[model samples]
Target chain A: MARIIGGLTSSHIPAIGNAIARNLFEDPYWKPFFDGFPPIRAWLDEKQPDVAIVIYNDHGLNFFLDKMPTFAIGAAPEYRNDDEGWGIPTLPSFAGDPRLSWHIIEQLVGEEFDVCSCQEMTVDHGFTVPMQLFWDDWQKKPIRTVPISINTVQHPIPSPARCYKFGQALGRAIASYPSDQKVVILGTGGLSHQLDGQRAGFINKPFDLMCMDKIVSDPELLARYTAHDLVREAGAQGAEFILWLAMRGALQGHVQKLHGNYHVPISNTGAGTMLLENAD
Target chain B: MSTEAITQDIPGTIIFNGEQAMKGYALNKMCYSFNKADSRAAFKRDEEAYMEQFHLNAQQKAAIRARNVLDLLAAGGNIYYLAKFAGIFGLSVQDVGAQQTGMTVEAFKAMLAKQGE
Candidate 1:
C-alpha cells in the first residue's frame, strides 16, 4: 500500500533557476523568493518520499506545436532533460522508477483514465523548476517519478472538473499500488498572474487567495470554473493553477500548511509556493 | 514553391494567412476529434456537419475539409493540433515536420545535430 506523505505546490518561473544557478539569492529582489522555498526543501529532506508523482504541464517543449495530448504520463525508467534553447546550467538527467511507474499506468488504464504513456520522454522546466527547489542534489539522487503532463499551453484544454477527477483517480491508483512506498504528489504552477498581449501583467491577489481556499476546503466549487474564467480573472496562463487541484483532490481532505511564499513581477507573472502535509 | 503555397491559390479552398494561423480553432477540433472514440465515425458520417459545430469561418471549414496541414499551420493553426490531424492521415509528426520544412526527416535530424554542435 502507498500513502501520500505530503503535497507541494510551487511557482516554476525559469528566473528562479537563473537566480539559483547565478548564486544571486542575496540580491534584494530575489532573496525573499529563494527564502520562501526553504520550508519545502526541509520537508523533502525530512520525508524522503520514495516516489514523487509530479503533476505539471508542458510548455510547447516536448509535445511541440505538432500534437499535444490532453493528459500524458511518463512511465519511463528515466527522463532526459530538455534544452529549451539555453540549457539548464548544472542540472543532470532525472532518474525514474519504471516498476512503480508501470504499476500506476496499469491502474490508470484499469480506471479508464485514458492516459498517454511514454517510455522515452524528455521533461522541460515544468518538472525541473519545482524539483530544483524541493530536493537538494535532486539531479544526482536515485529518485523515481511519475509525470502527469497536462495540456495547458494549447487551447481546448481539459476542463477543471476533468482535472480534479483525474487527480482523484490518480490518488486511487497510488493508494492501490502493491509497493509499500511513501509518495509525494507535487502540483506545480501559479498562484496568480497572466502572460499575454495587453493583459500581460495581470495579478489578482483576492482571486488567488480564494483559489487557495477552494483547493483545500471546496474543490467542487473550483471545478465548475472554465479555463476561460481563470484566464479572465487570473490572466490567461494563470489557468495552469488548475493542475494544483489534481494534486489537492488526491490528498486527504485536511492539509497541514507547512510554508508558503508569494511574489510578483517575476518575468511577467505573479508566483507563489505552498507545502502541505496530507491529513492522516 | 512549398506545396502549401501552391495549394493556397487553389480555387474554392481556404487560404490560411497571418494571425488566422494561430487562432487555434482547427487545433481545438483536432484534439476533440482524436480524444473522442466516435470522432472518426462522426467525421466520416458528415465532415462538414461535424465541423459546423465549431462555428469556424468559411476558410477554416475549407482548410479542414481539405485536410491540409500546411494550410492549417499558415492559418495560425498550432503544430500540436496539426500533428493530431496528421495522425488521422496515417502520418507521424516526423512526416509533418518533413512536409512543413521542405526537407526529409532524416535531413532535418542532421540539421538539428549540426545546430547542437
Candidate 2:
C-alpha cells in the first residue's frame, strides 16, 4: 500500500516569489525570510518522497468567478504555472501522477468528498512558491505532484472542521493506493494576514502561533474554528489557514513536527512553514 | 448553507460571495485578461473601450476610470482581480492597502515595519 511519509505546511505569498525572481535574498529586507528555507531544502534532500500532494488555492489564475470549485484535484499528466498578471517568474511544468490522482479521486468520491477532478490546471503562486521553497532547483523535476485545490477565495469556504475531515478522507485514500510510493502532503496559504478592506494590512502573529500549536498537536481544536472566526481572528485573506487543516487531517495521530518557522510581513502576510513527519 | 452567514457588513470590507461573483463576472473576466501582455497593452491603449467591452456597469466604469480602489471593492471587484487594475497604475497591493486604510504609501510601509518590531 502507498504510504504517506509526512505533511508540510507553508504560507504561499506571491511577493516571496517575486523576491526570488529578482534575486533579492542578499537584500537586507529579504534575508530573514530567505534564511528559513535552506533548512527545509536540506530536510527534503534527506526525506525525498516519490510524489507530493500539493494543497493550495487558485489566486484568480485557473478558476475565476464564472465557475469556482471549492475542492479540485489535478488528474492531468502534467501541470503548468500561469503568469499571475504580475510578471512573477514562471516555473517549469510539474509532472502529475495520474494513476495516484485517479485513485485518490475514486477514493474521495466514494467517501462523499465530491472533489472536482481537473484534467488540466495552471497553478499560481499558492502552488509554485512552496515548491520553490523546498526544492533548490525545482525545475529539475525531481518529484511528481497531484495539485489539490480548495476555495478560500470565494465566500462559503469550507470550514476548518470540514477541511480536517476532508483531510482525513484524503489520508485514507493515500494509504489505500495500490502502489508502494512514498508521498508528501503539502498545504500552502496563510498564517494571519489579510489583503483587503480598511483593515488591509492586518497581521496577527499571536493568532498564527496559536494556530500552529493547534495544527501540530490538536488539529480538531483548530477545526472548531468557523470560517467567520478565521476571518475575524486570522484576517480576511488569512482565511487561507483552512488549507492547513486539510494537511493536518491527512496524517495519522501524533506526527512529530520535525521543524518549523514563522516570520512576518512577507509582503502583507505573516509567512509560516512547518514540517511534520508521521510517527509511524 | 445559504448567503445568510456571509459577513458582508463587516465594517469597511465588502465580502465577495456568489452574489458579488455574478455581479462582477464581466469586470473580473476583463481583468483576468490582463494575465497576458497583449491584453494589458490593449487595456492601456483604450481604457474606455475595454470597459465597454466588458459591459462594466456605470459604477464599475467610474471606479476604473477614477482608479478608486475602495470604489472598486464596493462594486464587487475582488482584491486579487483589483490588483490587476492597480498594477496598471504601478500600484502594489500594499499601496492599495494604504489607499484602503487612508494612509500615505510611506506611512503604510513604516507601519508594516513597526508591526514587525
For all predicted structures, in order, the TM-scores are: 0.71, 0.96
Residues A69-188, model 1: lDDT tens digits: 888899787787644433345367777888777777788788887888888788877888888888857766666788889988665677788889888888888888877889999998
Candidate 2 vs. true structure, TM-score? 0.96
lDDT of 2 by residue, A1-280 (tens): 8888888888888888888888898888888778877877777788778899999999888998778899999999998887777777877788899999999999999999999989989988899889888876767746899999999988889998999999999999999988888888998999887778888888888898888887888888889989888888878888888899999899985698888888777888888888888757
- The prediction achieving the highest TM-score against the true structure is 2
If you score just chain A, what TM-score does every candidate get? 0.94, 0.97
User: Ten residues in a row with the worst lDDT in model 1 chain A?
Assistant: A193-202
The 10 consecutive residues of candidate 2 chain A with the worst lDDT sum are A133-142
Off by over 4 Å in 2: B1-6
Interface RMSD, one decimal, each candidate:
14.9, 1.4
Q: What value of lDDT does candidate 2 attain over all alpha carbons?
A: 0.85
- Give the candidate number with the greatest lDDT: 2
